[model samples]
Structure formats: C-alpha cells, structure tokens
Target: MKGFITDPLQIERESMRIIRGYLQQDWTEKELKIVERCIHTSGDPTLESVIRIHPQGIEAGLKSLQQGAPVITDVEMVRAGIAKKQLSQLGGTAECFLSDPRVADQAVELGITRSMAALRLNKERLKGAIVAIGNAPTALLEVLELAKDPETRPALVVGIPVGFVGAKESKDLLWEEHPELPSITILGNRGGSPLAATCVNALIYLAVNREI
Candidate 1:
C-alpha cells in the first residue's frame, strides 16, 4: 500500500512522480520543485498540467473543444470496447443533421473532423464514441422515430444553422422526444461553411482534451 507523508517536500516529490508518469517523462528537479510548490499552494493536480499547457494554449485548446462537433480518441476506443459488451451501453448508432445545404455543411464538417481526431488520439473507448448527423431539425424527428428501438441509443444532433427553416425546430423537437441525445455544443444562428469547419475543429480539440 502507498503511504502518505507529512513533509511538504516529500508530498511534492510524490506528486511530481505522479505527474511524470502521466506525462510520460522525467522532470528536472528545478521544474519539479516549481510544479510541486504550485500543487502545494493550489491543491490542484490540474494546475500542474495547466502550467505545462500554458494559458494561451489552454484557451485555444478549450475553444477548439467546446465550439466544434465531436471526436474520439484511442482511450475512447478502449472504453467503447468494454461498453460494447453491454446491450444498453452501445454508443449512438444513428445521427441527424440539417438538410439545408448550408446547415448540412456545418454538421458534416463537425462530424468528419471529430472522427478524424478521435481516430488519431486513441480515446478512452467508452467515452470516445461521437455521433454526427447531417439531417435538418425536422429530419431529426424522423431519425428519432427510426432509432426508437429500446436497444439503440438516440443519435447526437449538431444544430449549427439555427434558422434553416425546419432545422431549428428539428433540434427542439428532437430534444423533446429524445432528451438523452448527446451533443457537443449548439450554435444559435445560421453559420457559413467556414464557421462550420471551425466549429468541427474545435469539437475535435475539446474531445481529445476531455480524454487527456
């Protein structure tokens, strides 16, 4: 069993060891002490990683995750492997996105980008499954109806084009019918293709960060 130490230096040393293991590297003694002191004062392990990541990088990284669609990582794959065994834990099998050309572009961008990132990151398996749909809001209702079997989980819908005729309504109706649907983030107004790409990239960054 592991033993706890009362000495601040020892505690910091232990934390440094833990951090090194997770970061897959050795830390310089000078850096270790600095990191350890931060931990000692803040009492937050994340702070150590945050320091390594730096504020600008953290902000950019966060923006990438929250604004984009969905992505998976190798960690997620392993998690999915375990989850796949249970009938109820099967990740989403269906997806919905706006049918409007503009709206569809956003949904597709987010979906494709997320898939690419997830493939590269080796997500946590269980938590890494991300679903992307390209159907408008109204179309999503039909998708929900089609995916209603108790065995299949509701699809995650990304609604980026808020005013694409039936698209916005589709999102609302989808929420009403399948409240458990998983989605990364929602956009309130209609966005162009460039915006859609940015959103998708953001989602990929966010999902990977979430696993890390």
Candidate 2:
C-alpha cells in the first residue's frame, strides 16, 4: 500500500486531477482553476452548476489585481479568507468595511442596510477595486446602485451572497441591471464566504501564475 500523501503541493495537484476528472464540460484554463478551487473549497461538485462569469470578467479581474487595485470584501470572513500574502505580493490589499462603526451609524441615518451603508462609506476605495460580496444580499444590491455612478463603480464585482430571501433577486438584478459591468456570480441563493474568497483567490492565482 502507498503511504498517505503528506506533501501539500502534491496533495493539491492530486486534488486538482480528481476535480478535473469529475468535470465533463470544457472550460478555459482560468475558468477551470476558479471552478476547481470552488469545488476544492466546498467539496461540492454542484458548485459548477451555478457558477456564472461574465465574458470579460476574468480578464478584467486579473488586470485589476495586476494594477494593485484594492479588494473590498463585504464581510470580515470574506476578508479573512482572502490570500493576503498573495495580494500584498501583487501590491494590493484586502479590506472589509462592514465592521466600521461609521457603517452602523450611517445605516441608521440613511435608513439603509448596514451592508449598504458600508459600501457607501467605502465608495471611494471601491472605485476600480475588486469588490467581493459573499454574505449579504443587501451588499450586492448596494453594488448595483453604486455602479450607476461612474466614480464609485468597481473594476470587478464578485456578487455571490448567500440567502433565500433576497439573494436570488439581488443577483438577477445584477444581471439585468448592469450587463456592462464585469462580474462573477452564482445564479441561485447558494453562495458563501468560502466560495467568494475562492473566486478572488483564483484571480490572485491567475496573477501569480501570469496566466492572464
């Protein structure tokens, strides 16, 4: 019997091999990396079913990272999950505005969701940044609204918030309302911090590997 694989690199390679074997549809190299990472993170092959990417979204994401654009995450978990070392290496940073006290105050003052208020507070930072929203439907909705203003639009929006309430509707609005923006999303109400982080990490990996 062969010994259990202990090397991390070897383990990752073997895992990717397995993930590739299970996938039947042909995907570009970059797409495969993103999808496989999502599968690896979630241990769910079904993730591929709902993963949707805009035509130029991947390339736009890569370019943004290469330019050292900031990454704005809606929640702390998503921020924590990001590969900060990799982002730093690319001359970028990951930030989360949801915890700011000003966000709470503004939410109440503006009669908006805290997530929406957070986006409003970080509107300047969000400009040309890679915005990742994985936990709140309201955050995604806020991105859609902010996109209408040229100065506040993000370079790429990873809009995959998870919930049954407004998640599906928010993503649908993204597709319907902002077809011109570069984005990646899960079609249904089935996404989370891990998947959102995976999407951003995949983009970081693409930058590190010079695949874009």
Candidate 3:
C-alpha cells in the first residue's frame, strides 16, 4: 500500500494532474474538462487523439442543461450512469426507452435495431434535448437521420458507440459531414456507455462549476 491514496478528491486531483501532463491540445476549458474526464474514466492516453468535439458541442450541452433540457439515452446502462441526483437539482432529467414495449414492437416491425426504434419512436423528445448514445451505432445513425428534418435540435450528442460495426462510420459522418450538429464523439470504434455517461457528466460539472 505504499504511496497509495484513498481520499476520493485527492485521487481525482492527482489523476487529473497526471492526465493533464499528457494532454497538450489547445482545447477550451470546458472541452478540456470533457477530455480529462474521458481520459480519467478510460485510462487510455491514446484516446486524446481520437476524441472529437464539434465547436458547439460543449456550449450547447451547457446551455441545454441550464435550461432544464432532458437527457435521452439509447440504453439503460448509459441512463443509469448519469448524475441524476445532480441533474435533478438543475431541474433536468435523463431517460432510456430500450425497455419500452413500443421499442420492441417498432424494432420488429421496422426490421431495425431496438436502439434505432427507440429514437424513431421518440422524435419529439430529441428537440433541444441532450442525447447520449454510447452503446449502439444504430442509435447514433438514427439520431442523425432524424436530425435532418430541420426541427429536431439535440443540444449535444454524446455519440460514442463501441463496436466493430457502424460505430466508426456513424461518428465519422457526424464529425465530418454534419458540421452544424452539436456532438462529442470518439473516433475509430473506441467508445462505450461509460464514456457517453461521463461526457454528459462533465458537461454537468461545467454547468455547476463547483466542487461536488
């Protein structure tokens, strides 16, 4: 147990100090906070290179949270990982519809993924909401497709689905093709629910901007 630190706050501070030593990007403070939180949660220094952030991503998330926008996720795990207690203090909410019977029925009828069906059935909630998609590329793709309607405006999209399938392609399209879309993503198929949840948490941390 030599040189071991048990205090959570001290551990976080030390971890962040070490993480900062390796990150030399010219990102803004809020963007850097997201990067730091991702690196801390993932424990992978290489992620610094693959992380992508749209210019409006951080600001958009912050603004939405401040305005009490709900956070919609593709899966239960991502929803479960969010800081719901803190979000409640801000009058914000988080939800996941994977378990909804409508999701199952729509998925079977449409011959698409349940992740895709969740978004398809909840298009109304996507408007000005914070959408977090961390487990399914199909969901991210569906979100992008719905976003093209000129009415749905997700404040920020944490599109970090981890898989060998359409994960990279979905994020690639979001970062490359859709410049106006507000999103934070990890390129090259390296993502998961934790990253998606923590990315949103980082935005919340910024919104409150105090020791929690």
Candidate 4:
C-alpha cells in the first residue's frame, strides 16, 4: 500500500519489514520490479492518486521498496491483469479462477482431509492414544472432543494444481454442492507444501480473523 520513490536503500528496508517471509519466493523479483516501476513512473501521488497496479506489480513494488530500488510502473499492464469476466461471473464475491475443475475440488477435499487428520490424529506416528479395535467408539468420542479446540483447526487450505484431471467436477462439488465455507481455488497445476499451503493457510487465517 505504501507507494513512493525514496532511495534504493530505504525501499529495500521497507520491503524487508513488510514482506519478511515471502522475500524468498520466486515471484519476489517480479514484484520488486513492478513496484519500482509504478512509483517512478507515476510521479508522487502519495495515497490520494488511487494509482492502479497489477497484483504482480504491487508485489514487485513492495520488494523494490524493501530492497531500496526505484520503481517505474506501467498502469496499462496492471489493468490488463484484472479478470473482468471472471470477476463478473462470481459476482465479485468469490476468488475461484481455475479453468480446471478437479484442481478446485481437490483443494476443498484436501482441506477436509487435513482437518479430519488433525481432528482424529489418524496418522500412525500420532502420540495421542493407543487403543484396540474394540475401543473404536471411544476414539471417535475423543476426536469429537478435540475438534472443539480452536488451536487444532486448519488455518487455511488451497489447491491450484495445474493439469488437474477432474478439476470441473471438483469445483462443482465445492461451489454447487457445499458453498458455506470460505475458500480460494487457483488455476494451473503446480502444488506443494510451500506455495499451496502458504496460500491456504493465509486464507484460513484471514477467514478466521474475519478478513474474507
């Protein structure tokens, strides 16, 4: 949100503080470029100019600011990044932009699975309980009890795997079948612990914190 053209050193200092953890991500450089360009090109508007910048540009600007570099932004590029049709289709309420359906569905299903695992502690290495098969009902009871604790809940969950085989069906299941939950579905197929989890966890945290 902070947009200005200060010395490169100052810019880097601010970026370090604002994007402390994400500075290592792959998109950090792109973001830095965008920010630097936007600020330098737009002159000095402070907060009143309502300067528009792409998400990537904003990110780049932030990074440049953090790295203490001058930013020169292209407003046209930022405008192009906005998905007008997609935004209209979702009524500006949802963030699901994936063309593949399975990817979206997998996100929801994965979250459910993770939440269940966290609730039941179903993994083999779990340290909670050691009971026989006959004690199944008791274990279920314990799981229900633990689910009440807020700390154990999943903070966020996301799925944006590219080339998702059944993305359409999965997305339908979430939006059409179960629409109560707050979720974010992505497009493409490149998922793992860091990016996907980061997005999901951030979303969950925001939802829990009432940001979404």
Candidate 5:
C-alpha cells in the first residue's frame, strides 16, 4: 500500500509529474501548466487532444490580469475555484453574474437562459476582461455575439461549458467563426467549471510569476 501524502505542494508536484508522462509532445512551460491543471482537475489525460489555445490567448490574459482586469465567470463554482488571493496579488478580481438579481429578472423578462441573460447584463464589464464560461453553453453563445461588437470584446475568453446540447456547438463556433478572438477552449463536450477555473488560475499564476 502507498503511504499517505499529506503535503499538498508535494501532491501537486507528483500529480504534474504523472500528467507529464502522458503528454507526448513538449509544450512551453506556460502551456504545460495550463494543460497539466486541466488534466489534474478532470483526471482525464485524453483531454489534451481537445484543448485549443489561440496563439496570443495566454499573453493577452496575462496582460489583462497584470493591468487589473476583472475576471468574469458564468457560474459561481468557477468563481469560487479561482485563486483569488493570487489574482488580487496581481491586481485582478474574479466575479460571477449568475446570482445577480438583475440577471434573474432579465432572464424571465427576456425569455432567455439565466446564463445568457447574465452575460448580456455584464456586457460592458466584459470589455477587456478575462471571460471564463464553464457552464451553460448559452452564456458562451451570448459572449460570442457580444464580442462582435467591438465595445464588448474581451481580453481573453476561456470557453469550456459542459453539456450535451449546445456545449459542442458553442465551442465549435468560438473556434471556427471567431478565430480572431483571443481564447482557449476544449473542442467538444468535455469541459466543466473546474477546467475553466483551472485555465484562469494558470493564467493568473503566469501573471503573478511574470512568466508571460
């Protein structure tokens, strides 16, 4: 039997080492951290195949966080998972709009999903902010539509909603229709709040360490 591993730092180090063994190609240090965290969060090594990163996504996200950009999330779970301390140390903050009263009211009034409504309500704040969507594909769709308007463009979008319905389609649209947008995403329906949060946290770590 294996001995108990009580050190959290050592646990993480060992986990990353295991994940590294699964990766065949060599990725940059920053890119490897992002991938490792995703695998660590999901415990699925095959996830590496679906991950897609815009060439400038990491650098853009890091720059935004360093400049004190707000990080917007589609779900509270994602917001809660972010390393807020590290983010604050780098002059950034994370927020989730799903619980906003305005979003609830608007969803009912507009006959849209609360996630979609939430994104619409926060359109102004999304500009130049790092947007992370880990639930509700409708939210990702809304973000893409809003991004078409220059004033609502985000610094970097981490699109990884998980579901059977719109999740795959939403990510496909983000990758295909809006290739110009700075973003990171999993290509199919294999994503969730944890994966999205992991991506943002990796970027924050990169920013905090001045690696970007």
Candidate 6:
C-alpha cells in the first residue's frame, strides 16, 4: 500500500519540484510561475508547450495588481477561481457580467453570444483592468475589437478559452496580430477557467512577493 502526500504545503512544494523538473524553457521567472500554476491545475506537465506569454504580459499584470486594478472575467467560473480574499487586500476586484440581465437581453436582440455582449457592456470598467477570458471565444474576440482604442484596452489579457469552434482562431489572432497587447494565452484550442484564473493568481503572487 502506497501512502499519498497529505500535507498542503508539502504537496505544493513537491508538485512544483516535479513540474519544474519536467518544464524546460527560456521563460522568465514570472512566466514560469504562471506556467507552473496552469500545469499544476491541469496535472499536465506537457502543457508547457502551449502556454504562450507576450513579453510585457507579466509586467503589465503585476503593475495592474499593484495599482489596485480590477479584473473583468468572461464567466462566473473564472471569477470564482481567482484568489479574491488575497486580491481584495491588495485593493483589487474581480467581476463577471455574463449573468447580468442586460447582457442576455442585448445578446438576444443583437444575435450575439451573451459572452460578447458582456464585454461590450463593460468597456469603461475594462480600461487598465485585467481581462481574463476562459470559456468564450466570442468574448475574447470582442475584447480585441474594443481594445483597438486605448480607453478600453486592458492592462493584460488572459485569453484561454477551451472549445473546438472559435477558440483556436481567437487565440491565434491575439498572439499573431496583436503583439503589442500584453497577454498570456494557450495556443491550439486548449484552455479553461482554471488556467485563466491561475494565470491571474500567479500575477497576484508576484505582486505580493514583489517578484518583478
């Protein structure tokens, strides 16, 4: 009978040790923390190949968190996954508008997904905020469109929506065409709320630890 590791801190240390042993890339310290958290969340070390980071993404994220910026997410799952308790202490907030009646009504009338309407509805709150999208490609696409203007641009975009439809295309567009935007994403159509949340959590960790 084999014994499982049950201690919380020990588990984290062990998990990170193993993850680092398997991950070998030229990523900076902050980038590696975000990648490791995603890998830990999924229990998949091979994810190192898919995790993409814009050079300024980590820097932007930390700065925003330090400045007490808000986080606008695409769905409830992403919002729930964040470290809100710790984040609030840093004067940061997280919100999701998909559940708003206005989003649903606008989506129905405009023939758009609720996710897209959600982003469209929060242009003002999005400026200088962290935009974390994990489940809806439409929301990510819409954010990119709005981001064309400085007023709606986010401090950093965590665009990692998981699906077979527009997910891959949306992420590819951000990575390939929007190089100037600070963003962290998963390439090739594989992402979810856990990854998105972990990415932000990593940034918060860096901010708290002053890693940058």
- Per-structure clash totals for the candidates: 30, 0, 0, 35, 0, 0
Model 1 vs. true fold: TM:
0.31
Off by over 4 Å in 6: 210-212
Model 3, 170: alpha-carbon shift in Å?
A: 0.7
TM-score of 2: 0.94
Cα lDDT for residue 124, model 2?
A: 88
Give candidate 5 misplaced runs (Cα > 4 Å): 210-212
RMSD of 4: 19.6
Ranking by TM-score: 3, 6, 5, 2, 1, 4
The residue pairs that clash in candidate 2, if any, are none
lDDT of 3 by residue, 114-164 (tens): 999988888889988999999999999999998887677687888999999
Candidate 6: give the clashing pairs. none
lDDT of 6 by residue, 84-187 (tens): 98789789999998877798889989999999998898788899999999999999999999999999999999999999999999999999999999999999
Tens-place lDDT per residue, model 4, 34-149, is 22332333232231122222333223222322332211111122123323333333232122112233434554666543223322433221111111111112222233334235
How far residue 143's Cα lies from its native spot in candidate 2, in Å, is: 0.5
How many backbone collisions does model 4 have?
35
Residues 155-211, candidate 2, lDDT per residue (tens digit)? 999999998999999998886778899999988888899989999999998999833
Model 3 stretches with alpha carbons more than 4 Å out: none
lDDT measured at residue 81 in model 2 versus the true structure, 0 to 100: 97
Q: If scored against the real structure, what TM-score would every candidate get?
A: 0.31, 0.94, 0.97, 0.24, 0.95, 0.96
> Which parts of model 1 have CA positions greater than 4 angstroms off?
1-129, 133-135, 161-163, 184-199, 210-212
Task: Supply the TM-score for candidate 5.
Answer: 0.95
Any idea what lDDT model 5 has?
0.91
RMSD of each: 16.8, 1.9, 1.2, 19.6, 1.8, 1.7
lDDT of each: 0.35, 0.89, 0.90, 0.28, 0.91, 0.91
